[model samples]
Target: MNEVQARQAIVDAGTVLYKQGYVVSNDGNISVRISPDTIVVTPTGVSKGDMNPDMMVVMNLDGNVISKGLRGPSSEVKMHLRVYRENPDVTAVVHAHPIYATSFAIAGVPLDKPILSEAMLQVGVVPVAHYAKPGTTDVPDSIAPFVKDYAAVMLSNHGVLTWGSDLEQALARMEVVENYAKVTLVVNQIGSERGLSQDQVDGLAGIRQNMGLSPIVMPKGNAEVINGTDVIPQGN
Candidate 1:
């Protein structure tokens, strides 16, 4: 896409994330890769819901400002840059603090259950990276391990990040992550939850493969499976 289109996409995604309550105030950041070396990102300190195309900042893969606009690039742009550098297939990134998902992150939980088949097929398991101070190199370093293999991940004690081949796909992944978190929370509230059987989960894994999706793998066995039950903890 052209710079104009990329900027517009960032603006639109900001609005969607804001309207859907995934972000409040300037809590989230959006970016789209315009070329191997160029990216357009949302600016800092602006309400995403009120962004315009002109407010977007253009930067290089190294996070250097290429086109200075009315504002600076989001402080978290380093995370986005690291993602693009690690995964050439990814063209867009969306970062948000959607409540349910952020809650899981804060509690050091991974959304890895085979409970929802659709989520399993599309988003796979959402892993949690260890906490790193946000808006710093630590944030990028924390997420680097999961970038190449996982489409989405929760930042421990922080928020969530999702990326895809384009802006729309990235945005959709964010929605899926938030929805998965919400459903998991509801199941926890009921005090009883049953995950898909091993066979059923295998079936969905086959479907995910058929759709050319990446397999979900939790690092360090962070996901706890007991007696055929995938345990999603209710954080205190």
Candidate 2:
């Protein structure tokens, strides 16, 4: 997409995230790679729901501003930049604090259960990065290990980050993360979980490959029955 299209896409994505309650007042960020070196990103301190195309900031891979918007670039731009730098194929980045997903992040649990077949295919396993201060270099460092293998990762005690070949895929992955987290929470409350078998997971992996998505590792065991109190607490 060109600069104008990228800017509009970011604005549209922000509206979706806001309407879906994935973000609140100035609580999330979005970015789109317009070219190899140019990126259009949401500005900081602005409600995602209230963004316009002209409010998008244009910046280079080095984080140098090509055009300043009405406000500054998102404070977490470094984290978004880290994703693009780590995965050359990623053209869009989304970072948001969806309730269920952020709860999992807060509980220090990785969304690794293979119980949801569609989630396994679309979102893969969302691992948790070690806790790092937000909007800092350390935040980028914490997510580095999982960036190459995963489309999404939960920021420990923070939120969720997703990236894909384009803005639509990236946003879809973010939604999947929250959906998976909600189902997983329900399973925990149900006190029994039936994760997909190794063969089943392998089958899904093959399907994902056919769909041109990167392969993800799934748990290789049978169903699990959790009788303990490992459920994440109910809160954002």
Candidate 3:
């Protein structure tokens, strides 16, 4: 996408994410890799929902400000840069405070168990990275280990970061993570999660490999888990 389109797309994504309740106030940022070295990112301290095209920022892979404006690069830019550095396939990164997913992250809970077919099939297990201070090396470093395995991550006590070859898939993964977290929360309350058997899980993995899919890890459990059975009854 050209610079005009890139900035416009960022503005549009901000509106969409905010509308989805995935971002609040100035709580999230999105970036699109325009090339191997150039990235188009959202500015810090601006309400993503209300962002205009002119508010966007452009930087190099090293986070150097290639262009400046009224807005500044996000403090979380390093974390976004780290993902691009590790995953050459990733072209877009959406980091937001998605409510359900962020709730789990803030609680220091890891979404490590698989209970959905599409989730395991699409993005895989959304690991919970260790808590790190926002806008610091620690945040990106905590996530670096999982960056190669998962397209999306639940940052402990922070928020969600989802990426893909493009923006749609990345944003879709974030939606999936939030949906998965919502279901998992309900199931955990009931005290049980009876997932699919080992053989079935392997089958899913086999299918993934056969399709030549990128390596995305499941939560070391079943593949196609039973629905209500996995939905543990509350207070059980």
Candidate 4:
């Protein structure tokens, strides 16, 4: 997309994230790759719900500011840059503190269960990266290991970060993460939960591969069942 379209997309994504309560009080950042070398990103200190397209900042792949209005790029641009560097297929990145998903992050949990087939097909395992100081180089370092293989990850004790082939796909992955967390929470409250069997999971993986989608390799083990309750494991 051109610079104008990229800025507009960021503005629209910000609105959706704010309206859906994925972020509050300037708590999230959005970025779209305009070219291999240029990116349009959300500015710092602005309420995402109240942003205009002009407020977006343009930067190089190295995170250098190329063009911006009076405002500057988000403090967390390094994380976005790291993602772009790690995965050439990623064209957009969305970071948000959606309630349910952030809850799992705070608890150091990984949304790795094969509980939802659609989620499995789309996002695979949402691992939790180790805790890192946000808005610093540490943030990118923490997420580096998972960036190449996973579409989304829980920022331990922080929030959710998702990347995709486009802005819409990235945002949709963020939504899926939150929805998965909500469903998992409800399932836990309702007592026992049974994940899809390994055979079923393998079948779904095969279907995903056939559809030209990435496959999620679930760890080899039975679902975590504790005293008739299903427990999702915490990330190391």
**Each prediction's TM-score versus the true structure:** 0.89, 0.92, 0.88, 0.90
Off by over 4 Å in 4: 216-236
| Candidates in descending lDDT order | 2, 1, 4, 3
RMSD of 1: 6.0
- Between prediction 2 and prediction 4, the one with superior lDDT is 2
Q: State the local distance difference test value for candidate 2.
A: 0.89
Which ten residues in a row are the worst by lDDT in model 1?
Answer: 218-227
C-alpha positional error of residue 132 in candidate 2 after TM-score superposition, expressed in Å: 0.7
Better of 1 and 2 by lDDT: 2
Better of 2 and 3 by TM-score: 2
Q: Against the correct fold, how does model 3 do in TM-score? A: 0.88
Which residue window of length 10 is worst by lDDT in model 3?
222-231
**C-alpha lDDT of residue 59 in model 1:** 94
How does model 4 score by TM-score? 0.90
Query: In order, how many clashes per candidate?
Result: 0, 0, 2, 0
Clashes of 4: 0
- Ordered from best to worst TM-score, the candidate numbers read 2, 4, 1, 3
- lDDT of candidate 2 at residue 132, scale 0 to 100: 97
Local lDDT at 103 for model 3: 91
| lDDT for each candidate structure | 0.87, 0.89, 0.84, 0.86
Tell me the lDDT of candidate 4: 0.86
- Candidate 1 Cα outliers beyond 4 Å, as residue runs: 218-236
Query: Which candidate would rank higher by lDDT, 3 or 4?
Result: 4
